[model samples]
Target: MIKTNTKKICIVVSSLGVGGAERSSALLSEMLFDLDFDVHIVSVLDKIDYPYKGKLLNLGKLKAEDDSKMGRFKRLKIFKNYLKAHKFDYVIDNRTRIGLFKELIVSKWIYNAKNTIYCVRSYNTDMYIYPSKFFAKLLYGSAYKIVSVSKAIAEKLNNEFGFKNLEVIHNQVAIDAEELLVKKTIKDNYILFFGRLNDDIKNISLLLEAYSKSKLPHNSVKLKILGNGKDKMMLKQKSDTLGLSNHVEFLEFLVNPYPFVEAAFFTVLTSRFEGFPRALVESLSVGTPVISVDCKSGPNEIIVNEKNGLLVENHNIEALTNAMNRMLEDKNLYLQCKSNAQKSIEKFSKSTIGQQWKTILK
Candidate 1:
């Protein structure tokens, strides 16, 4: 009689950096470890810098960080071969559909494991979502699970690619309620927007345009941008072209963006799509009201329209403009929103979300 190996869970991701998906994976690993499951992680590139300690770790070092299909195939082969020797109860591909076909090929050929899962973190632009859905089918064919970060994303995945085994679990933050709820210095009159400018996926330009058009006094609603990106220079250039250079202030990344989240009158997020934005939840946890473009999943779920925070239609300049105007012109609304917003994060903290993961894995 053959004996079955004990369950060992491993998460395979591009890296465990300060990304929404990466943070969630790292948090889940911690939770699983606490639950006494043998948990480990595998990174595609060993050298990628991650924000937290003991969150995600690399497996056998590989040099195929290149974007080519063959290069990704080789790296996937190496990782899958390693797993073939040591069986795991569950193995998850935390990669989006960049070169997902290679993931499918290697899983089918090398591991042939009974339980495999694919996780997607974004609903991106309309242009790429269709192609990504097609590849997701090929990659996740007959898998144990196909999961997304938010209900908005899961719905899109189901309707677009027909992913049936989908689950919606929000990201769990290492939030300390006692640490976040004190009254912050009411810095006079500036609203804030924070995110990486690298891919322009955050869509800072539209936010700038809306801020510029609001005709609110600079002192009334100045925009402070945080998180550096590859497109930072162009985003700043576009702000200048639109005469918002004076209205915008860009800051370098910090150990904690919480102080900024506290200092700002409110926080804004203008992404095209998000799995579940950590910034949005963090700002709310800190008692700072948020105004976000209802990109895909996170914002609407967090903001109760006019109750806690406000949501605007995706990519609609006028809708975003109205949201800013409403928040700026209505002083009572700001105070009400801020007071109401702080309580919105009760369900998102690690304690609340960890048990959800326990159920998902079980």
Candidate 2:
């Protein structure tokens, strides 16, 4: 049932599969739908795995049918026509913006800059904003709003690009009651690492090294990694080289990874940098404590040292090893962290974040 006189909104995303930002975009659609807005989603790629609520414009399908130079131009014309036809009150863009000329054409010709909201979802601002200050300003300066997923990212953008129209809206977590009721399937005392297998950003190599050094291995506590990426083979080989092949288990990505998260002794993240780590928040949301490196932009905000989880100094192998050992050896500390997990992250709940979006959209 559609609400009367509802403002229409279009969400543009890179894809609806296999990435934190993509998952965030899908969740945002659901939030907008619940708010009674006429929501639409435009996925640039063909992959669609996450459940979302919106009428979809899958441009990827058209590309799959014909992927040539002229075909690309045809897709652009279709996208432009769709925007014009809908006349959406707001266009929330969640795709990575690179290549200045391409972004210029899309921003100036395709999208109505006054109503388009550009989202910056990574600490690497280069991926979202062009390198040249002048060009970046020309591309996004006129946007209705520039949403940064974390305060640190917002600060970086302001300090570097001097953009005035910036808002900080952290990524949100939806704690499903049904997922909570799902029984744990894995029968092992294991700590978990779940996210992309990419080592360039996730620094999964550090996680493998830290796990190998930790005392948990000696105690027969396994390390399980979930998700897939280009670095999967490299990581598996590294585990084998570290003689942890038998101890560490590699699992495929699941649509509902909550059961694995819930059953874990504790979840772990070792990313080199993050805009705002959904994994840490998701783990804590499930009442499972997390162990993470104090990364540049996010971990510090999420991990309240010795409260919800352990926060180790970034890139320090010894510190991470010690943190892992402490979580397993110190019984009282582990229980205390677990007890405080869910309550500490109430601020990041879907309702709270949704209200912030309401303010922006209104």
Candidate 3:
């Protein structure tokens, strides 16, 4: 038996604002606290709007003190100082890149943490294509265990980088099916495309095009978008140019947006990448069927392709249109997936996966 009295853990991150890593850390902190571990967070970034009520030590946002350059030795020293002062049993780093928050300094200085775990929330394979992959690899050994949010992430770590010592612990989430089935005042005919609208990586531009051609009646078929990012204005402008102004609705960020999850017929995700969308899993928990592009890993693992959800060819709008249409027109297929949607998410429920993390901490 593990010693319940001996439990002490620390989760370190740039900030607990709005991101997958923050959400995961928040949920896991709550779960670990329930299990009686003395949990605390070390926020290395400016004010963490810490949603979780656990103890948060605000280290008064460190100043780089040296340079305005994107990466310079001055900023690195500030991060190095933060790690030296605060100590813990284990350190869980959530920053995805090496240089973003001076995370490398923490890992290198606090190398004595009994267990240092890094949470990988993005597709590890494409790190090379995106900025910072090569640098992140350099900091790999500063941690004892790497917690990958999905198998694709883990495989990328192993296959591409030849790194070992990994574990797969999906995010834990749940939703109420009865609550999710409520019809909005708006008609049921509208399809939805939610997520960071501005990011080209989500292929929202393609989604707008495919949706424009959809037989989903222009009057009845509106696309509701949620979340904000750098490309928000650009996407909205593109929607106007495509003559799809009436078809798309942009919603500002929400503090508690589960109703959006409940209101839609199904959640739509067209990301060029994902670790495992915690939002998709939560939507499925509420019995919402999803039509997602077959991204590298997350969708295929959770969605059974016409079983619990519909998986379409990645980056192809025609295929996305056909799949979306099938969900709308084919009542039998829709019902088949609807019936399985809530049930398919059993593996990622709090009892199952949350306990898995508890096991890790213990």
Query: Model 3 lDDT vs. the true structure?
Result: 0.70
How do the residues 252-311 of candidate 1 rate in per-residue lDDT, one tens digit apiece?
A: 764356777888877889887777888888888878898999877678878888878898
Winner by TM-score:
2
Better of 1 and 3 by lDDT: 1
Q: Superpose all Cα atoms of candidate 2 onto the true structure and report the RMSD in Å to 1 decimal.
A: 1.0
Tens-digit lDDT track of model 3 for 34-141: 667767776656545436645675443443332356444544554446445555566676655544344445555545534778787878444311234465555664
Runs in model 2 lying further than 4 Å from the true structure? none
Give the best candidate by lDDT.
2
Candidate 2: the clashing residue pairs are none
Kindly state the number of residue pairs that clash in model 3: 1
Ranking by TM-score: 2, 3, 1
Q: For model 1, name the residue pairs that clash.
A: 198-229, 198-230
Q: For candidate 2, which ten residues in a row score worst on lDDT?
A: 175-184
Report clashes for each candidate as comma-separated counts.
2, 0, 1
TM-score for each predicted model, relative to the true structure: 0.83, 0.98, 0.85
